[model samples]
Target: MKTTSTDESSAGGVTPVAPDAATLESEKESMLRQPVAVWATALACVFAFMGIGLVDPILPAIAENLDAGPSQVSLLFTSYFAVTAVMMLVTGAVSSRVGGKRTLLTGLTLIVIFAALAGTSGSVGELVAFRAGWGLGNALFVATALAVIVAVASGGRAVAIILYEAALGLGMACGPLVGAVLGDLNWRGPFFGTAVLMLIALLVLVVKLPSTPVTGERTSFAAPLRALRHGGLFGVSFSALFYNFGFFTVLAYTPFLLDSGEYGIGLVFFGWGSALAVFSVFIAPVFQNRVGAANTTMLTLCGLVAVYVLLGVFHGTPWVVTVLVVVSGALLGVNNTMYTEMAMSVSDNPQPVASAAYNFVRWMGGVIAPFASTELAEKFDPSVPYFTAAAAAVVAVTVMLFTRSAVEVHGPHAV
Candidate 1:
């Protein structure tokens, strides 16, 4: 009887030996371990993401305090995402020229200044304008943070991605809770609180994070826009755009449908954010692995559509709406991960350019949804906006179906 060695066990092929348990354990450890700079940056990312939902618990309060209608208040999201979307194109260009560290500092400083200003605003218009400025800073910081983490982290790109996603999840989950606690005191409390926390993150980054020099060729301002010429990239971007329409509608408008106090809204969204975090960090990969990215995206979009429809049907029922809102987070979480993976893999353009292009297009949905949903509700009925959101989800599902082949061809092995 012939026996094979542990290193060479293949019968007629050259299949590589699988990593042993000790090697795998070492790799796991490496992935988990991070440098101080990376931790600081990640901490800043947490605060950055907190800004997304921090205003949620205070939306009603803001409206009541400033005598703004729902449509006017919703412009906060419109202006912020609009500026962020446009700035996405410039982030790569600026980072390439100024280096990542300066870009990050610049972004963080802008956020600190603007968030504090937003807290002091006497009118909704002022807050909206400040939020737009905050968006610019956020765009600059987020666009570069991932690349820096990937470059400096102990593990490879995969581990870096996991870390970034974890930060996003944690930040998103905690943002509402923080907002609720502070907004209970005053409508302006969440804004000032965000400013203080972001300042802390900024100081930590300044002290711990080393300056990252420009490493390669500078990217052009137009590079991201030009990347949309690729069929696969364009398809994914547009599909994500529609998906985000549904996403922000639920996020930005649902609070108006409920009579809940600031604390109640915060508690409900805390559950929503928690569900989002859990699914994004843990469940997304497993679902993607089992269903493939295209199918997974389609499934999640379908789920979103159903949730939106249910939300519309039961808008008057606070308990029902709250439950559906929390459930929708799971679907949104899966879709977010799948769409991000698709955007990253389905294009031949450099990762940064492609990411910028995708973000620019997709965020349009966020820019439009808040104002549009509020207008639709005011013009027709409250349920109309949810139905519109459901329609957008349908469009997203259709687009994903049509673009499956192109995406599959260019997608990563796992996808």
Candidate 2:
């Protein structure tokens, strides 16, 4: 007679040891305290965040060197995201099939390879192609990394979630300035530098990362497309999209503005970037807990209002502009983190789709910011991008307040 493995009947058991789905979940929850898994998850996050942002601060240089103007430059972000959106839809089930760690490693490797290629590219067209490659790796890494962490992290329940969020906060704060300084060396330097960082990150994951089995029924490709048919999360994703447009427009373009010695935009971005990095450490957990994601989102939107209002009002003053950018960057950090978390908080499958949708929103901004801000600047004034971004952030906040919560977020402390 052949013997049966509990492994065979273990998941969603036909005749489970537990009484119901709730009880089974409780039992599995007991196994979540793994330390190595937490570390691996953090490593992966650093790689992706750094990769995503590494080119940011150098947008001015890229535009000048590539023989592209501002509006045209923004296409870098837009096209990269367009690629990611497609990849995210496909990678979820692939992660389920191959296992999260393997999929993550493969994605990380691709990031390293293409990022180096991005650095070597001699022409604008080639650089753009490399960026598209970056988006592909990013979508794969991000789509699966969170789910892996959630399943594997040790100690407190969902400690991986907190760690993952922290890693993102750190990355958002650092990516742009790193791009700025390294950007002075070569536009390619920061990207290649990111590839180096990713290489180290991969090595760390090799020893530390633990594999997690995908538990739920895999949603088919048609499902995500079908999801677009429903409007709520899709709308929220676009809200994030516009916010990125506003933020990155400032982030990417400010250096150029200040390099001209007029608005002192460079100083503004530097200060703003610093504020974002610092605040991310201090108030993230508290803000999320107290105001809740939606309310905090409202608060962040208010900050954007101040940013563009100041930018539009005082386009010529470096001091005033720098102050505004700093405030904007800090609040943008909060907004990015909160909106991302909130977007997922409302989702039924929070980890994977949340990552996918949030990235989608962020990249949409990237795609639009460079071009739209540049175009708007040409027609009306340089400050138009700020105003446009502000208006969009406001719209997103409004919708979240009125919209049904798509996800119910409870941190480890909820119990």
**Best TM-score goes to which candidate?**
1
Error of 2 at 123 (Å): 1.1
What TM-score would every model get versus the actual structure?
A: 0.92, 0.81
Per-candidate RMSD, Å: 5.4, 7.4
Per-residue CA lDDT of model 2 for 190-228, tens digit only, reads 888888988888888877776556657675654455544
- Backbone clash pairs for candidate 2 read 33-154, 34-154, 71-371, 78-367, 263-318, 268-322, 272-326, 345-407, 346-406, 346-407
lDDT of each: 0.84, 0.64
lDDT of 1 by residue, 1-415 (tens): 0112345433321222234556545545775789999889899999999999988888989999999999999999999999999999998899889998999999999999999999999999999999999999999998788778877897544456656776877787799899999999998998899999999999999999998788679999999989999988899999999999998998899988876988888888888888887787667766765566788889989889999999999998999999999999888877777777778667667667887899999999999999999999999999999999999999999988988987766563231
Rate residue 69 of model 2 by lDDT: 78
Cα error of candidate 1 at position 133, Å? 0.7
Scored by lDDT, model 1 comes in at 0.84
